[model samples]
Target: MAITQPEEDIEPTGTKTKWQRFKSKYFRMKMLIWWTLLGVALGIILGAALYSVHPSSVVITLIGYPGELLIRALQELVLPLMVFALMSGVFNLRHSGSGTGRIIRWSLLYYLLSMILAVILGIALVFIIRPGRSRPFAANNFANCNSNVTATGATRADKSAVDSLLNIGRDIIPTNIVAAAAAPNFLGVITFAIVFAAGLITFGQRAEPLIQILEMCNEVFMKIIYAVIACTPIGVASLLASTILKSCSIISLLKALALYVATVLGGFLIHSFVLLPLTLIVLSQNNPIKVIRSFLPAIFVGVGTSSSAATMPVTMKCGEDYGCVPSIVRFVVPMGTNVNRDGAALYEAVSVIFIVQAHGLTLSVGNVIVVALTATLAAIGSASIPNSALVSMITVLQALSLQEYIPDVAVLYSVDWLLGMIRTATNIWGDACACVVVDTWARRHAKKNGTLPIKNPEPPAEQEMAMGVDSSKKDEVI
Candidate 1:
C-alpha cells in the first residue's frame, strides 16, 4: 500500500510542478514584454530630452555603447547558431530527401509571392500617394547632409542586379569555406552546413556520435541565447537613445521628408498588418493576430538592432510560442532572413520611384518595370544587415541607367536610420509568419500524400520509462 500510495502521489505532484513551471514561464514572458516596451518608451523620451540640449557626438556614442555590445554579442553567435541549427534540424528530419525538398519549395514559393506582393503594393502606393510630388528636389535639400551620405551614390553604382545575382551564386559555392565564414557569408555557411549534415545522415549509425555532438551544441547555444534575451530590454533602451541622439537634427529632415516617410510607413502598415495576416488566415486558417502578438519580442528587437540577421535568434526563440516546430523555424527563418525580404523590396521600390518623382522626372513604362523587377531581385540579394538595402538600392538605380540621380539617393539617407528600423520590423515579421505557414503547409501536404507519420507514435509505457518513471507504475501515472 505504501509503494502504491507513493506511486499514485507521483502523478499529481509532477502535474502540479509542471503547472507551476508553466505559470512561472508565462509570467516571465509577460514581464519581459512589458519591460521591453518600457525601455523603448524611456529611450525615446531620453533621446528627445537630450536632443534639445545638443549633446556632443562623444556623449551619443557613450549612450549607444550598451546597444553596440548587444549587437556584437548577437553577431558573434549568428554563425555558430546557423551552422548547428541547420545541421541539428536536418538530423531531426524523418526523410531529408522528400521532406527537405518540400520545405524548400514551399519556403521559396512563400518568399517569392510575399516579395512580389510587397513590391507591387509599394509601387502602387507611391504612385497613388505621390509623396515625392510635393517635395521637388533642390540642390540645397542635401546641403546639410554629410559628404559620406552623398558619396554613397558612387559607392556601388557599378553593381547591377545581374552582378548581385552572380555574387549570390558564387557565395553559395564558396571555394574557401574558411574565407566564406570569415567574410561572414551566410549563404556559403548555410550550404556548407547542409552538405556536412547530409554526409552525416548518409553514414547512418556511423555518424550518430557526431550528430549527437551537434545536437548538444545546438542546445548549449540556445541556453546562451536565453541568457542574451534576458538582457534585451537594457540593450533596446540604449540603442534607441543613441539612435535618437545621433539623429537629433531629424526634426527639420523629418519635416522635409514627412510625406515620403508617410508613404513608406503606410506601405509597411498595410503589408504587415492587413496583407500578411489575411494571407495567414486564408492559407492556414490560423489566428494570425495571435501569432503576431507572440512575435512582438522579435519585432521589438528588430527595431532596436535594425538587422534581421541580428534578430534571428530572438525570432527562433519566439517560434515555440508561435506554435511552430523547431525544425521549421530553424530552416525557414534563416533562409527567409537571406531571401525573403518583402520589406526591403517594398522600401527599395518606393524609394526608386519617389526619388524619380522628387526630381520632377518620370520613368518610362519600361524603366518602371525594370525598377520593380530589380528592386525585388536586389532585395533578395541584400545582406540581412543594417542599411544593406540602402547599398542594394544602387543595383536598382543602375539597372534603369539612373546613375545621374544616384547622388540624390543621399537625400534619403537623412531618414534612412528611422526607415531602416521600420523595414527591419517588417522583415522579421515576415520571417515569423513564414515559419508558421510553411509548417502548416508541409504537414497538410505530407498527410494528403500519405507520408505523414503519427505524431508521438511511441507508446506511453516506453515514453514514461525513458522519462525515468518506473515501468510498473506507468499505468498509474498515465
Candidate 2:
C-alpha cells in the first residue's frame, strides 16, 4: 500500500488557516478603516459639488434624497428598540438585587460629569486655539453663503438667556408618545423607556414573563439591525458616488474644511484619548489603553456612519465583548449614544465661535453662556436620526437669537457628513468607557460583599447531588 499520511493533521491545519483569514477579514478594525476612507472621500467631493452648483438642480436633490431616506429608516428603529431593550435589561437587573442601584447612580454621575468636562474643555480649546483667528480665506467668499435659509417661516428672534433655558427644559417632556415616536425624538424615547423600565422593576417577579418576552423581542430587533448593517456598503457607495458626480473641483475647499476637521479631531483626541482614560485609571483602576483598544470597532463604525444611532448595535457588541455585563451594555450604551455627545457638544461650541469670529462679531459673556447652554441642550435634544442635526442646529441658533449673525445654516451643513462621523465616534468612545467603569465598580463591590455578582447561584440540592455523584464514581473506580 502507498504511504497514507494522517488525514486529520492536514485537515485541521487547512481549516485553521482559513478561519484565521476569515476572522481578520471580518475584523471591525479593517471594516472601519476601509469604510471611513470611503466616507471621507465621498463627503468632500459631494460637499464641494453641491457648493459649486449655482442654482439648485433636480439631479443634486435626487441623488441626495436616497441617502437621507436611508438615514430616516435607521432612525425609526433606534428609539423603540432602545426603549424596549433598556427597560427590559434595567428591570431585570433590579430584580436580581445585585447592587444595580449603585451601578446606575455611578454611571449617571459619570455621564453628567463628563458632559460638563467636555463643555469646559471645548470652550477652553476654542479660546486657546483661536480657530476663529486663522482666517486663511477672505470673508467675502463666505458672505453670499451667509443668507438665512429656513424651511419654516420663523424669523430669528431676540430672547433672554433665561428664556432660552426655559424653552429647552419645556421641550424635554413629550406631550404625546405617539407623536414623539412618529417624529422619533430621542429625549422622549429615553423618558418613556426609563419610566416603563422602572414600573416593570417595581412590579418585581410578576413582570418576569413580560421581561423575558421583551428580551426575545430585543433579539429579533437586533437581527433586523444586522441585516441593515449588511447593506451599509451599498448605501455608502451610492451616497459617495452621488457626491462625486456633483462636485468637480473638490480640492479647493480645503482651508475651511481643514479647520472644521482639526477642531473635531483635536477635541476627540483630548476627551477620548486623554481625559476620559485618565479618569478611568484614577477612579476605576482599569488600564486606559485596554479600554481604548477594546472599543476600536465601535469607534470606527461611529466615525464611518456619522450617526450614533446607526453605530449603537456595534457599540453594544464591543462593550459586551470587553467583559461588560450584558445588562449594563444594554442599558448604558443606548442612553449614552443619545444624550452624552461630547464630540457634538464640542463641535457646536467651536462652530459657533468660529462663525462669530469669521463674521467679525464679538461675543459677550452672556452670549458665550447662552452658546454653551444651547450647545449642551441641542446636543441632548438631537434626534438620533441622521441629518436631524442640520435642522436642530438652526433651532439652537434661533433659540439664542443669534441666528441673524449666523443666519445661513448651510455653511455648517456642507461639512455635516464629515462632522457627523467624528461626533458619532466620540459618542461611542464615551459609551464604551462608561461600560468599563460600571463593570469594574460592580466587580469590586461584589468581591467586597462576598457574593457573586448578577449571576444565579447553584441550588443547594443540585450541589449536594453533584458531590454525591463524584464520591460514588470515585468509590466504584477504587
Candidate 3:
C-alpha cells in the first residue's frame, strides 16, 4: 500500500522558498545591532590611528562626507515623519475622545517632572564636585577662547528672563507654516500637527479618508526611514572617525576638563540609570532592565548621531518593537524629543554653575535660582539637534549677568562632542522610559473606563520583519 507523503514534505515549494527568504532577511535585520557595535569600535580604532598621524582637513572632510550625507537624509525625513506620526497617533486616539487630553496632560507632567529632577541632580553634583574651582583651565585655552570669539565677531547682551519666555511664546505660534518648517522650528511644527489633528477629529466622519491617508503616509515614511537606518553602521563609523580627527589637538583641553566632565557624566549616569529607571518601574510595574534592553538599538543610534530629532525614527521603531501602542509611541516620543530633555537641562545647569565657580564668582541665592529656572526653560525650548544646547546655555549665562564669562563657553564647546553623544543617549533613553510610563498608564486607564481600544497583539510576520531587535530574541533571530 502507498502511504501519503508527510505534511512537511508536501508543503508548496514556492511557499517554502518564501519562508527561507524571509528568514534570511530577518537574520540580517537582527544582526544590525552587532554591526553597529562593530562600526563604533572600528571608528574609534581608525580615528585614533589617523589622529596620531595628524590628518589634514581635506582628509577629515573626505572621511566624514558620508556621515554628513546621512545627517541630511535623516533631517529631510524628520519634518514629514513627525507630522505623519503625530497626526496618525492623534487621529487614532480620537476614538477615545477625552482620553486623548489625559494622555497629553500625562506626557507634559512627566516631561516637566523628569527635567526638574535632572536639573536638581546636576546642580547638586556640580556644587559637590566643584569642577570650576581653582580655574583649572590653562592660559592657552583662554587665549584660544578669546581669539575664537574675536575672530567670529561674537557679541553678547544680557537677556531678561521675560524675553526668554516671550521667545518661546513666539516660537509656539508661528505666523507662517512654511517658514516654521524651514526654520526647522520643531516646537512650532509640533504645535501645528497637534492642532491639525484636533481639527480633523472635530470634523468626524468627514476626516476619515484623511486619517487613512495619514496612516498610509506614516507607513511609507517608516519604510523609508528603515532604508536609511540600514546605512547607520557606515554612517556612524564615518561620523565618529571625523569627530576623532577633529579633536586630536584638544588633548590638553580634555585633561583640563576632567573634573567638569566627571561631574556632568556623574549626573547623567544617575539620571539615566537610577532616577529614570526607578520612575519606569514604580510607575509602570514593567521591568526597567527588560525595557532598556529592548531600547538598545535606539540608544546606540542616538549616541552615534548625537541629535534626538535625527534619531526619532529609530526611537519610534524600537518603541513599537517593545510592544508600546503606536499611538503612544508616535505622540509621546516626538513631544519628549522636544520637551523631555533631561540631559540637556542637567548639562546646562551644571555648565553655568561650573563656569561661575571657574571664574571665581560667587552666585547669590537669586542667581542660583535664576540658573535653575533658566536652564529648565532653555532646555524646554532647545531644538533637538546637535550643539543646540550651546545656544541655550548662552541664555542661562546672560540671565545671570555673567556675559563676561561667555567667552569661556568656547572652552566647554571643545569637549562638547563627546559630552553631546553621552547626553544624547541619555535623552533618548529618557524618551523610551516616558513611552513605557504613558503606554502603561493609558492601558490601565482604558481598561477601567472601557473607552479606549485595547492594543492588538504582536504584529504579524510581515510587520515583525521591521521590529526592533530585542535581547530576548537574540538567539532565535541573531
Residues 425-452 of candidate 1: C-alpha lDDT, one tens digit per residue: 9999999888888888877876897875
TM-score of 3: 0.55
Where does candidate 2 have its weakest 10-residue lDDT segment? Answer: 469-478
Of 1 and 3, the candidate ahead on TM-score is 3
Error of 3 at 249 (Å): 18
C-alpha RMSD (angstroms) for model 2: 10.4
When 2 and 3 are scored with lDDT, the better candidate is 3
lDDT of 2 by residue, 1-478 (tens): 7987653233323233333432433454335435444554555455555665533446655655655554455555545455565564454345333435575677767776776677778777776766545332223333333433332212223345566555445445778877765554444545677678777767777886887787677667656654554444445444544444433223433454566567757887798878888878877898988888888987886666566665666777788788876656665675576567777677777777765554445555555666676666556655554444443454345444454433233345446656667777777787788778877887887899897665321112222121111111211110
Q: Of 1 and 2, which scores higher on lDDT?
A: 1
Q: Could you tell me the TM-score of candidate 2?
A: 0.55
Each prediction's Cα lDDT score? 0.68, 0.58, 0.69
Residue 383 in model 3: lDDT: 56
Ten-residue stretch with the least lDDT total in model 3:
469-478
Model 3, 371-478: lDDT tens digits are: 787687667655565555755676666555455455455456445767888888999999999999988998898789876543322222332232321222211210
**Model 2 stretches astray by more than 4 angstroms:** 1-56, 88-92, 98-100, 119-157, 182-185, 225-253, 277-478
User: Which pairs clash (backbone N, Cα, C closer than 3 Å) in model 2?
Assistant: 49-247, 306-420, 306-421
Q: Ranking by lDDT, best first?
A: 3, 1, 2
Per-residue lDDT for 88 in model 3? 60
